[model samples]
Target: MAKSILIVDDAAFMRMMIKNIVSKNGYDVVGEAENGQVAVELYKKLKPDLVTMDITMPEMNGIEGVKAIRGFDPNANIIMCSAMGQQAMVMEAIQAGAKDFIVKPFQQDRILQAIGRVLARAEQ
Candidate 1:
């Protein structure tokens, strides 16, 4: 079965870009959220196989979302997406239980590769 993914980002264009890449690569986009709060809620409802989360967002940030999700589901597979130069935030997100990260201005191959790696790790 295709891996189900939840794409979380505050920017519509960013979400669109990620959606395009993951869907074309055979991942199912089960849902999307504009912020961490919504992302957490959608995660409960959809229970997707993976999540691509943005580091910065309105309402709540990706690190907080990762924490919230991890609190409920310790095994949640999350990949953080952030702009370059936010190494601090990226580190926090990973420490909060994110499996990996992809930088913004994203490349299709890198996005797919990160997703693949995170999902593969979950299987082990």
Candidate 2:
């Protein structure tokens, strides 16, 4: 079966862009959330194979989201998404349990590569 993914970003356009890319690449987008809080809830409900999470959000940030989800499922596969110059927070997200990250104005190849690499790691 195709790997299921949950997309979480405050920007609607970003979510749409990610959905279009992953869906076209044969990954199933199982759910979307506008913030980390909702992403955590959806993570519990959907139990998706992976998650693409945004760092800056209203209620909860990506680092916190990664922590929360990792708290629930220690082996959860999560990739952080951030804009340029948020290197510190990206590092925090990785420490908080995110497997990898993709920078915004997302390059299609980079997104695919990150997702592919993370998912492949999970398989082992």
Give Cα-based local distance difference scores for all models: 0.92, 0.94
What is the Cα-based lDDT of residue 71 in candidate 1? 91
Give the lowest summed-lDDT range of ten residues in model 2: 84-93
Task: Compose the digit string of candidate 1's lDDT tens values, residues 1-124.
Answer: 9999999999999999999998998999999999999999999999999999998899999999999999989999999998954778777888999999888787898998898888888999
Kindly list the per-residue Cα lDDT of model 2 for residues 1-124, writing each as its tens digit.
9999999999999999999999999999999999999999999999999999999899998888999999999999999999954778777888899999888787999999999999999999
The prediction achieving the highest lDDT against the true structure is 2
RMSD of each: 0.9, 0.8
- The residue pairs found clashing in candidate 1 are none
Model 2 alpha-carbon drift over 4 Å, by segment: none
Candidate 2, TM-score vs. the true structure? Answer: 0.97
